[model samples]
Target: MVSTLSRRTLLGGAVALGATGLLAACGRGGSPTSAQPGSGAWTFTDDTGATVTLDARPTRIAGLNDAIASLWNYGVTPVASFGFTGLADDVNFRGKDLTRVTEVGTTYGEIDIEALVAQQPELIVTHAYPKDSSGTLDPQKPLYGFADLKQQQTVAGIAPIVTIAMSGSAADVVERTVEFAQSIGVSQEALEQPRRDYDAARERLRAATASGLSVMAVAAYPGEGVYIAKAPDDPALLSYTELGLNYPDPGGSDYYWQQVSWENILDHRTDVVLYSLRAMSGADMQQQPTFAQLPAAEAGQVFPWEFSAMDYVAQARTINNLAEHLEGSRKVT
Candidate 1:
């Protein structure tokens, strides 16, 4: 699975994550992390079961871009995203306005400590996976993007760290993020509209999935062959299954994907596919041997696997998008 991980992709340690919006607030004495001289109004218990307390709710925060996408939907913006380098070109940031956010980590394995220090974040929020979904790397990395445990510890020195777990239902993960945002000062009023839209989207997906399209998710590599997503390891797939999606369990011992040779992909049955564009573009995958002959490809039922930015509105759009696509889809498997 490590063979498929590229620095440019969210598959770096994690991916089952996301959402968007901006909120302006400042932390204690304007420090990267501190109490509000004495008031201490901020405290939250994260998904990882860690409680974070601060003087005033952290106004200046630094975090992973994936979470930023979700918070952006609620207008609870961060001061910076550790992995951002400011490319506003639309790959669907889901309203994570990069223009107002600082880029603290310029590379995949490194965070710019100096840049993070400059942001004066009272708290640091990021995604954490106790086990590497890919199963090839160290499973102990407490946070995504940072190099290792020591690196995570190093960053924590600048500000208190809170982690959002990336495992489970995408909806559950997103709502957990919503709860976090609310704790940090985002109003329930700001979240209700998105919540309504998300609920509507789910109904649309439920209706679409009734058409019975056999679906699969995959990542194709040039020489390493194709990787079929193992549904049990994907929060997006898990959640969608509840929405009535017919995604099969592409079984494997690995944590997330089952690797098959180019020719071997023919053994799998699918009517529609959610391909990882980061692994290879749709045009390229269409040209691959054996893969091209699949019913999903021939019928143009391929879609991008984009659970990376999972705010409620963003996912609502994604759910509605697939439902819309099903309007043109047929049973080709």
Candidate 2:
């Protein structure tokens, strides 16, 4: 979750826990319960293969903004949520309401631990990557409001945290999210229509990709620079490729993107650019002197790349929108 400095300031915390205790506090565990007939206990195996059990289904859930949106699609809303930088103005969240949900913090680390703890969440849900080679979770990964180790330990002590994996494709993330939703008692019937809609949208994307307009996803930086998304590292981009989209790889071992100066932006030419909505806007890019030199920019073949979309509806919308762009694009490079 990238953000400007104003939106990403780290909040101060006094408490600290040892690394072992921190892992233990954040580790998975569930309690037995008799909340409902045939629903003895709630247990979930997260992306890291950690199992968390709860005595009863979680009614009061806390999550990151994207996770909250995912849960909303399943008719389950979080009691509290944390947002990334510029959250109030985030184009991706347009038309969505976050009024009733308590705000814990922003992506740059402004966590209100007292407020979050006041929510009394039975479960805390957020995205997580697999354990590093050292078999430990990395706080640097965008797991939620816990960007800092001290913050993570402080929050972990408030309630059980369920870290869903973000390393797989968007489809994989959605599937795991669905399972988590089901464990919390969201009905399968509620998911049926969304699944169908997603399938339809996916087919549209496939058909559009058949047009062969080379595409690239990128985010602009302050210093006349751009970060071209490395398809393999981005689940959404990977999913697009799986659907037959010809997104060029920037050819680097970087986890998610290849940073390059704007002077070199045209080196990775494409017919279309999926610009990051979380970063710079179209107008912002237009201000860049070299941006107009890019074929995609000159042709006005830019579309919002909503990399944080988690719900079926949002995913479907993104696919359909990209399909429209692909269908209309002309080969420029």
Candidate 3:
């Protein structure tokens, strides 16, 4: 037996393992509860299940990782961002608007706590959670479960931390974002349009899947290792599968994606290589041995992607992104 499994089933089992007691805790107020504070401020559950309260709609925000990309997609401009080395030119938002934003330093591993505190942003967003090797949430400073929320609190002080899951379906992203906006005082009237538009985009992508193309998304430079963006039970892949393209089959217990080598990647024979760059440029990818040797590279089939597109919400936008990027490149037509 191949022993295929689903992440939802596993997480669901874990949820069930503790649900009875957790539910009791929730009823007794030991658990975090969602609350609306004001017209522009509210409280929502960060990914770590911690309650976060925003004082108001923040005009000054700092983003770590692709959270800025997600915010920009929502039309909210951030004042500053972390990790803008070779990427200051293009990817989505420009660093020119980020001058006043200040560099809070890089993302992942050890965060630049001092610079982040100096920024004094009203909002801070990141993508991963702060956990010890045990995978338990670090209790210090009330770290939010999600990385975006934790980074926000670290920078914004007492500002309500929000962790929007930018790695899910468009509807999932929109729903979470609306919940976030609502918590922060965005009125229903203001959210209705985006909610509708995002849903429309999702539907369009799903419908277009029938005509979808085979896309193999990975980091062009595999120095740290090649990252394959395949989520276990990720609905986003449905769009690609619908588009008639084969996404890389994930390894067991590997929900996020895989970091593989050029040898392992040959198993898929992926047609289109979607590459992600952070602090590096597309031109820099030529220096990578694996990337240089791949047939996809030899055929001029490599497509440069952004760090933001490597996550879950990548479905709705990445589809369109892949289609557009592929249009200009040579394919096996």
Candidate 4:
């Protein structure tokens, strides 16, 4: 019930998250253990290099919003969730029934630890970023959504935590999340239709990129400015680029975002704008005094970039919607 802005602190600043051990994170989901359920012991080595061992497969699970939404595609729902998971009209939720899931942390950094503990989850899964907007963690925080390392550790103490990379390629992020889902007794039978949908959607996206639309991704803070993504550094944007999307120059030095005032918003010109829903609605961004003068904004070329949910169903939806936008856009810049 407590929906909030994006906890996508991953793209909030100039911090460069070089790369992560995504393959190592995927090197899990022991078939015997995961497939057989409680018949044998279960163990998973997360991106942080920690091996969480359990006497039996963990049945009750808790996770960050995006992680849980991703798991839902494989029919694995969490008992508790944190972060801004429902920002995009729950489209990333893939029609999964989340009524029973407890909202642990509605925004970022602030977790209702007591509510999470009440769920008695056996395992907690979330993404890992090098640091957050908060400078408290110094060089690295690793855990993605929690306020800092201490909060993440406090939650970890309640239930063993498993992490996947939040700063790698979309495929790597999706794979790690899927592996986590598979490790927790997801039905391979349930994956068939999604596989077909994903393949179709990806091809559609590749084709739509041929529309020659120059798109720029950004998250705007009303009073401050806008943080535009450096395409190669962002997981989803990189994936789109790899699929042949022509994104305008994504300016930034700290690795991901280049903070620019409204006066300089035109520096990153594009035919279409992939704005994050975390900041505000597209309508609100359109209402900005100076933002209204931008060519794409005036041309009604803005689209919601609902940060990643990493699930096949959700990802396919994002791909298809973007493809539709690309196919319909006119180069206003």
TM-score of each: 0.85, 0.84, 0.60, 0.84
lDDT against true structure, model 4: 0.70
Model 4: residue 133 alpha-carbon error in angstroms: 16
lDDT per residue as tens, model 3, 1-333: 001311211211100001110111211112222343345453456544545565545666765535565555455556556542322543544443555345554432234667656666676654322121122223332222123435544454534344443333433443555455444444566555555554455455555434434566554343445556563234344344544455656463444446566556555455567665432344565466655566666677777654332322333455566555555544442
Better of 1 and 3 by lDDT: 1
lDDT value, candidate 1, whole model: 0.68
- Put down candidate 4 lDDT per residue, 42-125, tens digits, no spaces: 888776556778888899988877677787667776898887444335456545566878887766567898999999999988
The whole-model lDDT of each prediction reads 0.68, 0.68, 0.45, 0.70
Among all candidates shown, the one with the greatest TM-score: 1
Model 1, 1-333: lDDT tens digits are 545453224332332222101101111111122334467767775544456787687888777776776777677667877653332533446345567888777555568888888888888887654243532222343356676667778888999877666666777777777767777777878888988998999899889999988888787777878788866566677788888888887776766667888888888879988777556777899888588898889888888765456677788887888788776799997
RMSD (Cα, Å) of model 3: 8.4
TM-score (C-alpha) between model 3 and the true structure: 0.60
Whose TM-score is higher: candidate 1's or candidate 2's? 1
Number of backbone collisions per candidate, in order? 17, 3, 18, 1
Looking at model 4, which ten-residue stretch has the lowest summed lDDT? 13-22
Regions of model 3 farther than 4 Å from truth:
1-41, 54-65, 72-90, 106-123, 129-160, 165-170, 187-208, 220-227, 233-245, 250-260, 279-299, 309-318, 325-333
TM-score for predicted model 1 compared with the true structure: 0.85
TM-score winner, 1 or 4? 1
RMSD of each: 6.6, 5.3, 8.4, 5.1
